[model samples]
Target: MEDCLRIAVAQIPVTTDARANGREIRAAMRAAAGAGARLIQFPEGAASGYPSGAAKAMLAGWAVDWAALREELEEIAALAAELSLWTVVGSSHALTAPNRPHNSLYVISDTGRLVARYDKRLLSFSELADWYAPGAEPLVFEVDGFRFGCALCIEIQFPEIFVEYARLGIDCLLLSSFSRDPMFAIQVQGHAACNAYWIGFAVPAQCGDAASSGLAGPDGRWIAQAPQAATRLLS
Candidate 1:
């Protein structure tokens, strides 16, 4: 691991097709690799729409499809191996025990190995808690000799998580989410700035709605930003 590792933030548009999204992600990873980035981050719930109401049906059936998820994750891992860039992407995942689903974030090594899984800890009161289970584990991974902490979406708002990670000596933080609220986005940015840690805000946006999709550095500045419309955010 190098001391001065460059990380790339990818800004991408979200579509209804998962394969298409995957392809776009693949391209973004390659581009980041070309940019000399050792690690890359992606948006939350990117595997499926950040649905509300009845649209939850879009993610209904695939809890046990670990094999398929592996295949998709492998695409990233292969890229990591070929380009030697560690990757993180948001996902639609299910638990093996009860077959429940979770909004997940995964870190894949350059060799395509699944390093860690962090489920979205905070679910929206309206749509999320009812559909997805609260994640049990905290985010922790190694990149460029630095121990990094990770979270999905709303986790960035709760200062406790950041305190815990900072006390544990985390050097950086990466977050993936699909919240479309600008206020929430600002909250995340503020949290990162106050903590003085490198934070990646990988979140999905609503079509033309007030949304935030971007990356934040330790100084609490926007490193990269995505439009409110369908798009990607890479920093």
Candidate 2:
């Protein structure tokens, strides 16, 4: 364990194609590793795009290929091991038939092992009604002596979640979202300031127009940010 750590927050374009999305994610991981980052966080649903409106209809109508998605995840895991980088990537987790899948963040260790998973508990109305199954518990892990917590989009509105993470003694919060709201940036910074912990806010490149992916310091200032609407890594 070291006294400091270098992390990368990615802003990548997400699409309906799982393989295409996986390719972008892998590219970012390599870039992060090349930049000397030990850990990298990605946007919400980085592996499986967050479907909505027409996209939702398409997914619900047999557009999703779970097998392909699984293969992509395996490849990503292998790459993480090769690069010796820890990764937190958002994706959809399938369940037994007739039950909806969970919106989840798969935490891969530097050894390329699927160490843990954080499922999104507080889902949007549409997510609950149609898209995903709610998760049951909060997730926390440690790397290089720093404790980290995980949270997903929409969960930002819940103060309790942040407070709980603070109580759990996390040194940083890894929050991923697919939203394009400007307030998300402000709220994430506020969370870091309030908790006196760092926060990596990872959003899709498309949403960068409103709020690009960034690392917020405990002082509520942006330490690093990816260019607006661009696919890049904030190291």
Candidate 3:
């Protein structure tokens, strides 16, 4: 068992263009490698961009190319293998119609394998509830000696999920969110303090007023944070 692990929280802007998002992800992976981080986490919808209400409306007219999205994901996995880094990133997973896709987190191992996937269990009533299907199972994976659990966006508002992770003996929680509200930081800190575990929060750089991508210790204090509106690698 390793005594310590180095992880990176990548806070970067995401767009509707999957190729552009892929480039950003590659760049973040390189930065994580340079920082000597073995694992990296990216914000929710990092690959597809968290569609706004406006974008959501446009989806009806826009035809989504699932093939291209899959290719981009493959490219990310290749990059992870080249850098020997594990990655946790958010992307949309397609489902058979008339079911909508899932808002999911992909766990890629150092070998570039898609080891696990975590879908957002709790759907927000506002935008996501109509767009995504709720996930029923929890996702937990391990690195070195540390066990990590996954969550997305509004799930932070629920304490039961965090409690479940604590019961499962996770040392850390990886959260990917697009929320720009100041309450985001407060909720995460409270969860960390209450659960007595480390937490990594990742949000898009363009998310105005969003709490910066940061890692908090078991004490619920920030150990590191990215600069406002800047694309940065926080470890």
In terms of TM-score, which candidate is strongest?
Answer: 2
lDDT of 1 by residue, 76-191 (tens): 67777888778888876756766457778778887777788888777767445456777876778887688888787667668888887777777788877665566766776787
**Model 3 regions more than 4 Å off:** 61-63, 127-129
Writing each residue's lDDT as its tens digit, candidate 2 over 203-235 gives: 988889999999999999999988888888988
Q: Tell me the whole-model lDDT of each prediction, alpha carbons only.
A: 0.69, 0.92, 0.88
Model 1 spans > 4 angstroms off: 52-54, 57-70, 126-129, 205-209, 226-235
Per residue, candidate 3 scores C-alpha lDDT tens digits across 148-229 of 9999989998999999999999999999998788899888899999999999999988873568889988999988988877
Work out how many backbone clashes candidate 2 has.
0
Top candidate by lDDT: 2
User: How are the candidates ranked when ordered by TM-score, highest leading?
Assistant: 2, 3, 1
Ranking by lDDT: 2, 3, 1
Q: What is the lDDT of residue 167 in candidate 3?
A: 96
TM-score computed on alpha carbons, candidate 3: 0.96
